[model samples]
Target: MGIYGALSSAVTGLRAQAHSLENISGNIANSQTVGYKRMETSFIDLIPDAPLKSQVPGAVLAQSRATNNLQGDIQTSANETYIALNSTGFFVVEPKVGQSDGNSVFAGSNYFTRRGDFEIDKDGLLVNGAGYYLKGLPIDPGTGNISGSVPEVIKLSNAFLPANATTTINYQANLPQLPKTAAYNSTVYNSELLKIDDFVGGSTTASVTGGDVLVGTNPALAPAGPLTAGTSMTIEVNGAPVVFDFYNGGTYSGSGVGIDLSGGKVLDDVLAEMQTGLRNFGGGAAASATVGLNGAGNLEITLGSDYYGTFEVSGAAGVDMGIATGTASSEPTRPDLTTISADKADAFVANSVSGGAITVYASNGAPVNVQMRWAKVDSAAAGGTDMWQMFYLSDSAATGGAPAWTNIGQDYEFGSNGSLVPPGVPTATINNLTVNGVLIGDVELKHETNGVSQFADVNGTVTVSTLNQTGYGAGEFLSVAITDSGRVVATYSNGERIEMAQVVTAQFNGINSLKRLDGGVYQTTSESGEPIFDLSGSGIIGGALESSNTDISDEFTKLIITQQAYSAGTRIVSTADEMLQEALNMVR
Candidate 1:
């Protein structure tokens, strides 16, 4: 029994050493394989039951252990689909079960793998070098969000992306404080600009009862009694405010200045004073204004050709001038350059100043050049608001056919701070907007709070900081790439980049306990808990690959040790056989 047990122990030793050698050989063979884990053989001694003083010799059993958790060296690759895991996780994948109609059919069972040499196959399926298909959640094109929770073999669409109509446009820009345009009326009135005296049925300067009638009337100019000599009157013009000092009437102050009423004092006297005050308010020499009566018996004050702004009149606590009572009236009509006719529109564009332009896509995928021109219609004096109108031309041929600028019909008003004052919703809608004969329905312009503004820029230039429209023309599939965060993005020839899908990853608590499959893939086992899906993990690296964890030098060292142990096991078997033969001879 003792000889037989020794022979049995020697045989077990030989088997255990053979297992170790097998593991070492496997490790060495897969040294260059991507995502290959090294297998280590563990030996355990089996002891037989015996008395306290005596012990029985034991054989060794070899158990193969997987070093799956060990990280591999990462190397960058030019292939966009090649990905590497820097942390403890594996890419969820699926293997093809069968082929149907020349297409690979998935078995539906999820597998985990570190191999990520994925490339888009003919069927648009992301297949790795190991013949495993990558699984992930598809991203919705409209919402740009992950659509499904259950992972499936990620398939890309090579179909052409349809065109999108221009729905909403986010625009941000600054309009010049004083916009230069041909339509801006530098002169308030083309003819005799005047201030009328309805009290006297004539103008203060013109003894003749003709000209544009001043709307308001003043009291009869009678001889004054003993009164205070120091009284003041204020008139606001184009935002510039000026004060005029008035003395005891019949005659006021400034004997030789243009405001002097040394002659027969009438409405003309007050008109002269207002004109002089306004001229001085704007630095006098360069500034000029005329005051007289109009055909309607109204007081009219017209600014010079270069000075187009507002005006207001008010008196001090004790002033007696009838002119200083209420707010002044602006110009009758504001000038507009946009005409309904095409030829006139072209002329307007040729003569008028242009602010900025942008290329927006039409509904039919045609590029439309939208030229924006800011036309100063009237200043604060002209219309009680510093007003400007922006016009757009969608007609491709502005010179050939009737090139007309479609009026948005909204005046962009500016506050004193150079910021935009929303007239209503601060949005503009273009109805039936046709560019190059393509009817691109109603395009909404989003010009909320900060979308558009007007400030005093020395350069007098309008800058469009941001101008993006939610629209795109039809595009052809160009290429596909993966992001570090595991998002698969597809680019198109029409300058459209869409997120196609997101690569799914899984981590297990007992990763080494998972059942190993062919080609470095693992199947979920009872010992290995269910796959825990992770989307935003920091392990995935795109355009790179993970090298095998097996080290050739270390595997070769183990191989040498395994060879020596195997040889020793053989020697033990031979010794056991020789001893058994001797025992048999003694029996003989």
Candidate 2:
């Protein structure tokens, strides 16, 4: 029984030394492993009952256990994927198997690990080298809800989508008012008038009876025959009217043949004819009425319903056409022309209810629809452009019929592709114009795709110029770091930081009690307490790995100790065998 006990003890010693050597080898092998921790072996003793007088007892090798308190050095790498736990924590990985509830399987009832080197799979799932999917609170794509079962793997490549394409753009500008002289006018007059009557005749000669006949017998006009009565004739004295008659058979009828005796020129019959001749000698026979000078050279005239007056002869008539004064009537006021020249169409007072539509080109020169609401009406000034208040709407189709004016308190600048230009700016051309909310014209835009570009005012025109170009290239991977909250941040060449995942850390009550599993992993057992959830980088020192705690010198020393122990155990077995052999030989 003693010999058997010695053999058993030697075997136990050899096995324990071998186990210790194996542990040391493991520590040395994984010395460079991130988050790896080294382990040590411990042993217990066993004793059997002894007799009182003999005072001897047999000792037996007992169970060997691993020391779990070792900590390892931490290492860092430039790779963002490389991570280390600052505290006790395990990465939760889910299997591909479906859950009994018919949902996707997660780490809730699955496995855990310390490996954090992960990448996104083709399906945009985050996964590890073993194809195990990392688990996290699931996120809803639409509502961003994070309450469902965690996905197996997170896909990194498909993390971002393209930005929304610009559908429409609005442009507005005031048009220079046209000059006032360009206006047209309208005035007219009557061409013709209506006439009353028409007549054509001359005085007649007839025998006078109880009617007077005026005649003159001068050598210029002598009556070759008997005078006649009822002879109506036009007198030349002051262009007046007169009546005369001649008696038959040379009879002189005083009543019928009477002439003006005021000039002492009278003739009955021939005498009257002679006076008539004298009176009508100087001036020609009158047609209608005439104004002339009398023989006395005094202004003489006939005042009667059918007679007209005559004026004395003069060199020329000086007539004063009355000075006609026009009444001061009000004239419709014309809008200020000079000031209007500088005013843009947008500056006009807009009474239109429906905002106008303006089509503007985007940075890519694509036409975009924009709705412009009336902004303001500013008068033109020297060295300053007339300002107009303009607004835009997000949804033109919904609010186009009646666009509401945006509050002025909000500041607004032309969008990235837009620009403003004053009047007479040669480089800057008017892109669009609106009047009373009416879109009058369109503006052309110039743009560039690369670099930071801005529109600048150049001589009242807009010109797009390059500003700067920094970090404007395809994105590249950059450094990464873990936060105390366990968040993994991956930085990019574009100065963008992405939150990769929350490093999960797990804590077990008795880490030494954990069962070593394949793949440098550990499994939970009844002795090992349940894993307590925590985050990596958190100061909590639970189940987290402290890298390979193996010091090079310490590991080498342990290796020597293990070899010596193995040799000693073998020697003990050899000595026991030799001793037994000797006893057996003596018996023989």
Candidate 3:
């Protein structure tokens, strides 16, 4: 009984060692496999059912212990589609069994894996090296939300992206408080501001004085400081110069040309002096210069006449008093966009400044360049707050009797503080916006609160912060890639990237107890509970892969130990055989 029992125990020991060796060899063999979970050996002692003191250390059994919970070292890959799991989760996948009617037939059997060497196959399906297809929830292209609860095999579409017409344009800009239009000259005072008559044909032309802030002095509107030397202003009436030269106070003040400051001389006295000087000029009578204070406190002069030439105002002040300058013409302007005619398109371009441009799409995927211009129609210096009317090029090549630029049909008004007026409508609709005769449907120009503001910009040009439209031209299918956002994005030829599917990650209650499968995949067992789906992309690393968990040095150590243990078991067998042979000889 002892010899036979010893032999049986030796046999069981050898089998157990062999099983451990098999596990060790597999771990060492798959050391370089991507996402390979190393398998460990667990030994169980099978003692004989006998009295406690008589029970012997009996046979041993070896079992595979899964290291699925142990994470492997994460390595980065150049492929954007490759992904790794940082948490104790697996990627939901399925196997493609057959093809039916030019489509792939899947087994619908859900499997989980950590293998991340997935690449886009010829059929536009993401498949790993193990021949398993990635399963994910489809995402709506318009709403960008996950469409279904159940995960399905992801198959990409290669259809062309349809053209979308311009609907809403998100625009934002800051209008310069003093716009430097093409007609503006910095050396000439008030040249940066707009003149109302420039846009309104046959309208009364206007101008403003720069130097009249009321002080508490008796002549409250007179310049506070005594007139500086060489202070003079010139008004050119049809080539005649009426000069007003300033002199010290109380020294025989002249009303025609030279004027004395203070000494009971008020702002009205200065205007009276300017008016008298204008009357003295030769052709000044033909052009009436009505000089007074507008509502904004700027001394203004209205020029209303049949003068062919311009009524120009230029000056060099001795102090900080604002003076009227810049050439204000009465030539029924077209470049100012006032006397607009179909044949006057060239003049319009010469007056207004560029307000930036964008390309909008038509209904048939046709691209059109929508160019805009900012033309000031009214000004605070002209008895009202600054107002602007925007225009877009409708017909670039319009001939006689045809319209070229069309007004957007709305006015942008600004307060004195460089901001839009109260109850400001930041948004405007460009109704029937036609660019080069391409009738783009009524496109809405959405400008959020404070989107359009009037501020002091030295550039004196519209600064476009955001100018994008919700429209895209047609595009062909391009490529696909994955992101850390846990979404599979497809790129189109139109420089558009759209999310196609959301990768779903799953976890199990007993990760280490899952049944091992071929090609670094696993199956659910009675030990491993049902998979818990994680819609939220947790522990997903994009553009990277997970390396096998097997360590070569550790596997080599275990290999040596198993080999020695098998050898020891063989020695026990040999000893038992020799003893049994001797006992058989004695019995004979």
Candidate 4:
């Protein structure tokens, strides 16, 4: 019984050592495999019933232990789709079972794996080198939220992305406090401002305008003021020139700069005298055309309706006010108060500076330029703070009465502080913004808290701070990428990045109890319980891969120990056989 016990124990030792050797070899072989977990051998003792005084060593059996909890080195990969897990979880995956009707059929079975060397296969499915397809939940495009509880094989399509109409535009800008439009003359007052009549169209009572800041009687108006004892000014009425001299003293001397004074009399001095001097021009409407100050203390000239010719004002002094400089041309009877024609795009453009432009798509993917222009209609000088109207080209080829520019229909007004007047409306929506007859649909313009303002800019131009529109023309699929959050985003030719799917991962209550399958995947075992699904994208690192947990040096050391144990087991068996043979010889 003793010899038999020795032999049995030695045999079991040999078998157990062989099992250990097998596991060591497997670990060494898979040392370079990505995401491979090393298998370790655990020996269990099988004790036979014996008296306490005659107890002996037990027989052993070797079982495989999972190193699934061990971490591996994370290495960065050039592949955009490669992913690695830094924590305790496995990527849920599936395999193609067969092809049916030109489409590969998937086996609905869910497998879990740490292998993340995934690449887009020809079928547009993300598959690892070992042939398992990645699974994930679909993400809602509108809400950008994960959609489903059940994970499915993620399939990407290279189809063209449809055009999105311009919806919301984030806009930020600073409008010049004083816009120098084309009609503005350095010589004529308030010429840089948008004439209210120009946009609204119609000036039954033709008039020339000045600003509200200065009093007509104040000889110290803009351009150059605080007049000298003698200063000369000339004005035209119906193509005829009327000259006058200014005098600050009560008595006018013939020692003045220009002519036409009575009784050595300057009719009631100041600007009123200049107006009286112009009345002698003998115009058909000369008597009716009155040059006077308006209620706001701003100089205004009512060009009577009977006047058929042009009017010009020039001065050797600053008598032209802050309106013009040097030589000048005749101002229009009104401010070209007619609606601008499409052919007059150049003229309108000269009058209005660029508000910036963006390309927006229509319902059918037609693209059009949303050209914006800031046309200042009134200023502080015209009895109000700066006011502007935004216009976009309605049609480039519009003719006759057909409109050219479509007003955004909001009069953006600014305070003297250069900010929008409060009750601050930071956002405005252009309902069905149409350009060149292409409907861009309703678009919200977001200024985002004092985003639009008027500041005194020397350049006198609209400065755009931020401009972006949520719209894109039809685009072809370019490529796909996985983010750290486990979202698969697809990029298109039109510069749109759309989330395609969210990768789903699963964790286990007993990870080591998972049964290893072919191609580096694991199946659920009874000991492993049900897989707990994880969708938080924990420990997922994109653009990298996890190396195998099998350490070569550790496996080599175990291999040496297993070889020694196997040799010792053989020696024990040989000694047991020798003792049995010697006993048999004695019996003989």
Candidate 5:
């Protein structure tokens, strides 16, 4: 049949040059990753017998279409959890229970991903190093909402406490003038003289008695020599020593001549012994004595040593006793001797009776009273004195009772109350994330169905489920970011950073009717149509990363056209085995 139709058209050009050199070695092995996106390989031609144009030639090697617009080149990573999606997003990931198998879950239904390298598991679950589970919106441990189902476990909450330290002060008062003394001792008198009588008459009248006399006299009063008429007589001052029945109002009955009534009773018994010696003579013996006044106003003493003679005079008629002896300038002067001084040597010279009471003492001997208010001895005011004005009795209304000296102000402050303990463990949030390179995505195919044979629908039997699960720990991979509502944030190494998964783009009304599977994955066939997810990278870009659509110069020009079509299909089976070996060697 033309040598098997020329070896089936050179094995379809060596399987399209080994699928264009495996997509030019996956676009030079991801050309430095970071959101990589360079994919291309597309071809379509397999029309053998069209409805009415059949010249009957065979050629069928169809469908390849991947050219999803290759874009890759973003690189900025000072890692605030490294992100990169200027437009479009995907990352959804949930179907976990024992990762994939089982008719690939009938090929569809929600397991999309663009790897955003997430992390957080030690129960704070936002997982991804193939530990999957990043699906979003179920936040509410207090309203961080989005709405249910992707949470296999991510809980964090509790931390914030620290603040306190400041307060201290104290003070006291009492000090003014402060000094005093006085306890008891009085007995003063040098001349000690005290006598007053402006004029006193027995049965008589003579009034104009205005007198002033203050005397501590006997500084030996000297001035004697006047009033010597009949040596002054007339003293009947009889209050009880009476026996003088001399009824001679004016006629002393001539006693000096013959009326000497027994010498007038011995001169009234020597004038009653000289008036008892001038009343015990003590003002220096009554100032050198000399006195006379008799006619019964008895008091006739001639004692300048008894005046050189015998004397007898009695009832001699001339009764005028008005005793008088003034002239020392009328005496009055004495009160000068007050000495008490102190300005601290334990000052206290007591006797301030103008409103008493004073105690004061505190160099820690505590005893304050001070209450004087008016005391003056001011001997011409230069400390010969007792000047007082004092005040301070405590109940502190600012030095309390009588506090005026400009109200005493200067000193204050006081306060207290404190206690609380138990602030122990907390300190681990370090290094805080920093990746800076290699982060390509777009390889998320997931499937899990085991209902009839059990990879895990449990009762529906068909088993397999245990691929030794358990990964994602060495500070697990987390960096993925992008939110302004097109969600997909991740970030954990303790500094948390949330919003895990919302991105879901997947559109196909006809990406050449989809289907190419083995790893650069794609599926939806039946003339591809029903996939429309939303976050517009226009329905297909999802945080993008397609890469490897191979074009190393069109795969090295299809590897030189598949090595000349595998050397022309081995020369068409060696020219059909050389024409059947010459017709079987001429029929032998």
Candidate 6:
């Protein structure tokens, strides 16, 4: 019985070693297979029943343990759709069962694999190199979001993408502070008819007589005497001080004032000296203050068209100077450019202009060049409020319409600092705008409150920082690419990149328990837990492939060990047979 038991144990060893050899052979054969996981054979010793102190060594059993958690080397592949997994998750796929109604039907059960060498077949199905179809969630074209939670087989179509109507335009630009135009004359202080500067010099008070203000006798008196020669007076105009000095008989009266108003200065001479002094003071004087005779034959000094403050008198002789008391308050005003007729578009375009041009798409996939012109109609008052009219020119309008330039019926008013003032509404909506028979829908213009501006610029140029529209024309399918988040993006001929679908991954608790199928695919079993589907956050490697996890050197070494063990097992069987034959001979 002991000899027989030894023989049976050696036979079990032979079978176990043969099973190990089969695993090694398969590993060596599939060393270059894509997404292939190496199978490792584990041996267990089966001890026979015996006494408490006597333990009997028995047969061996072989069990296969899959290295499913081990990662494979990622390699680059020429195919664009080929993807590789760098982590523990597997790609959810489906196998084609049969044909139904001339369409490829898929099996109801779900399959998972690391093999991602996928290519579009004739039926637009993304089939992997292992003949399994990839499953993913479809994305909605309108909302650019995933449609549903349940995933289906991803199928691509080469259909034409429809044209989208223009809706919102993100516009940001800097309108020239002082735009250059044909009607713009730098020499002319006030070019516009009803500009703010034109109404700035208005006076509502009566003037003062110089004879009443200058009561001191005109004589050669002491240099430091009051209201006599060498007497100085300071007058403040628009917060700027101007000094006037009386000289002694055509010579400097040793006064500190820089002007030489000698030889009995008249009212005009006093006014001229004050003007020169004011011009040289207060940052070189942006405006001029002058003394002129009004219709009442009274002497009055008017502030400069650019100055916007009251006048005051200071210094030695300011006590007797009645000029500060002879003034009235005035408010700044601007012309309404919107009241102008619609036919004034050509005039506005030709006269006042600083414009920007951009290419926009039409409904029928045609390109339209839109030329926008901002005409500065009225200059700003003391508060920097300037008025500008908006006008547009298109190729279709120029050729077919009666007017070459079309007024958009909009006004942009800028503050003194070149910042755009907010209109009554937040956004400006243009509705039903047709260009070359292509009707554009309601397009909203976004200015960001102060995006458009008008300020002082030496060159008078308007710069557009950004201009983008939401709509796109009809597009033809170009190609498809996958993103890092497992999203499949399809690019088009019209420069539109659309998200078509998102690939999902599946993870299991017992990955080793998965049943291996043909073509590197795995099926779920009761031992393997239910797969958890992940729509996003899967580390998907695009344009690459996963290589086999099997190592050739290790497989070869295992093969050698398996061969030696199998040979030894055969020798044991022969030895057992000889032992039995010797026993039989003794019995004979």
Per-residue lDDT for 301-389 in model 1, tens only?
56544323445666551124234365564543333333334656644553345656666777678777676766554444432455566
Which segments of candidate 4 are over 4 A away from where they belong?
Answer: 1-3, 45-57, 174-192, 201-348, 376-383, 398-402, 414-423, 449-465, 579-588
Candidate number with the higher TM-score (1 or 4): 1
Local accuracy of candidate 3 as per-residue lDDT tens digits, 1-588: 398998998898999989888888888888889999988999999988999778889889888889999999999988999999999999999988899998899988899999988898889899999999999999998788999999998888889988889998898888887787777876653455444354345454434345544444444455523345457777665566677787665555544477776565566777667666665562532245665555555555544432123456676651245654564534422234422445766666665667889999998889999998887665665334577878888888888757888778777899998778878866899998888778898999988898988888988788989999988898899888888868999889998888999999999999998888877788998899999999887899999999999999998988899899999999999999999899989977
RMSD after Cα superposition, model 1: 7.0
User: Who wins the lDDT comparison?
Assistant: 3
Worst 10 residues of 2 by lDDT: 188-197
Best by TM-score: 1
Off by over 4 Å in 2: 1-4, 51-71, 95-109, 139-407, 410-503, 535-546, 585-588
By TM-score, the better pick of 3 and 5 is 3
**Residue range 1-588, candidate 6, lDDT tens digits:** 377888898888988988898888888888899999999999999987888678887789999998889988999877678888888889988999999998999876688999988888888888898899999999998888899988799988789988876677777777776676766676654343223232223322211233244334332231222345555666554455556766565656443355544544465555555666655562212255555444443445544554333455554454444444323324323333322233444455546564666556666666665667776644453223466766565333343224455456666777666776655224566555555455665667776767677656677766788788877889999888776678878889999988889999998899999999999989888998999888874778888899999999998888889889989988888988999899999967
Q: lDDT rank, highest first?
A: 3, 4, 1, 6, 2, 5
Please give, for residues 1-588, the per-residue lDDT of candidate 2 as tens digits.
567778777887888788788878888897776445577776655555566664433433434454444545555544345445554555666656655664445444546655555555545455655556655543343343343443334334423322222222222232222111111111100001000010112212111111112223242232322223323222323333343332234444553324332322222234335344434442221222222223432212221111112211111110010111221111111121111111222222222112345443333333345543433222121111233233444333333223222222221222224323312122212234333343424332212222111233322221223211111123366545544455555566545555665555567888778776544456788998787765333652322224555688998998998899899999989989998898889977
Rank candidates, TM-score, best first.
1, 3, 6, 4, 2, 5
lDDT of 3: 0.77
Give per-model TM-scores.
Answer: 0.76, 0.43, 0.73, 0.70, 0.22, 0.72
Model 6, runs deviating above 4 Å: 171-240, 243-331, 336-357, 371-442, 445-467
lDDT of each: 0.69, 0.40, 0.77, 0.77, 0.32, 0.68
| Candidate 2 Cα deviation (angstroms), residue 404 | 15
> What TM-score does structure 6 among the candidates reach?
0.72
Per-residue lDDT of candidate 5, residues 1-588 (tens digit): 355565665566556546755665666575443333444455444545456644444543633445433334444433232233433343444534542543112122444444444455444445544444444443432234555543222222222211111110010111111112132122321111111011111211111111111123221131111212233322211111111232212344432212122322333333343444432331222223344333333333332221111122233232322224321111112232221112211112232221233332222223334332221222111111112222212222332222221101111111111010112111111011111111111111111221101011222111222211111211233455545354555555534455544444555556544554332334566786555655322333223333323345665666576567657656766776787678779979
The TM-score measured for candidate 3 stands at 0.73
Candidate 5 regions off by >4 Å?
1-90, 93-108, 111-135, 141-147, 150-554, 568-574, 577-581, 584-588
- Supply every candidate's count of residue pairs whose N, Cα or C atoms clash at under 3 angstroms: 26, 58, 3, 12, 32, 2
